[model samples]
Target: MEKLYEVFPCSETQKVLLATYTLKDEARRDQKVSEFQELKQGRMSVAEYEAKFTELARFAPHIVDTDYKKARKFEGGLDLEVFDRVGVQKLPTYVEVLDRSLMAEATLAAMKQGKAPATTTTEWRGKRSGFGFKKGRSFVSKKQNTRTSNSSSQSSGSIPVCSDCGKRHRGVCYRVSGACFRCGQPGHVVKDCPP
Candidate 1:
């Protein structure tokens, strides 16, 4: 049998005692002893931790997943060690940075009040809209994704438009503008842009 402390060393003494008491209460309240027997035996599945849960999007908005896919191809950029707690097999690009690693532990614990671990095809990212930069980083390319189109880079044109605000300016937008030699501003040449 696994030691209680080994199972949950982080729980406070009082909390652990209460959890055990609660489990006993649940056992008595279940009204289905045969169902409980399945759990006691190996027929039931065990719960998983946060890292694997988040990596695979198995858990709820338990944690945010960053666009690790946009990172560079370098080994340092493909850091998946952080998700080791849960056996999540995620592409290096699907990981997200979290403020607190332990937060997932709590979320998973609450969810696992005891359930089986099942493999799921989890889509951690949100659906696309017609706006905004495609993703957070540069590890992966859009050419490799669903929005695959020949990048604007391949199209030859005398000018470019700011993807944001759709303004017309030249010689670099004062802000994050996709400006070109034409129509990036209000009736003015970039050379004559008021200083």
Candidate 2:
């Protein structure tokens, strides 16, 4: 009470009015809950979502009490891709969700930068051996493969691996020579790389 009085620096009547002013009115509480329900983690960072959640929770703590409920709520607002990646995760608490969400955001960012997102490739039938050329028409140069074989023998096994994408292949790596020098990724030149 003394600390409050000292910090506020107000008379008794003023303090009473201030206290009433800071009181959580029912109308404001309902509004906050509505805002919380509408919250989405679209373009904002996870930190921003968490901060907003914290603010709104002050008005409606009941809505986010349990770990399951809190985690679900947090997942609901995530960006489409991030939400898809982390949605199936069974987080135990709001804090766990926050931490995992940050990790998911980082992964999404890395994926945007051209790093392949870790995903299970169950359907291998539809997948191609490497970028460019149909099956047997791949462009591995015989001279280049023979000369580079001893020097760059990353794959000692029977399955030949491409230097660019690291995928196994039978013939020359079509992406090896013509890869974009600027981005260092296969399949496109520097001028064709995304802006």
lDDT of each: 0.34, 0.64
> Candidate 2 at 73: error in angstroms?
1.3
Backbone clash count for every predicted candidate, in the order shown: 12, 2
Stretches of candidate 2 off by over 4 Å are 1-24, 116-195
- TM-score of candidate 2 to 2 decimals: 0.48
Off by over 4 Å in 1: 1-83, 86-95, 99-107, 110-112, 116-119, 122-195
Model 1 lDDT on a 0 to 1 scale = 0.34
Index of the highest-TM-score prediction: 2
Q: What is the Cα-based lDDT of residue 139 in candidate 1?
A: 36
Q: What is the lDDT of residue 26 in candidate 1?
A: 72
Q: lDDT per residue, candidate 2, 1-195, as tens digits?
A: 558889868888988876676664656778889999889977788878888888887777788888789888888888888777677877666655666676677667756765433322321222233222223555544444354344334333444465777986433234654546554345688889976
- What is the total number of backbone clashes in candidate 1? 12
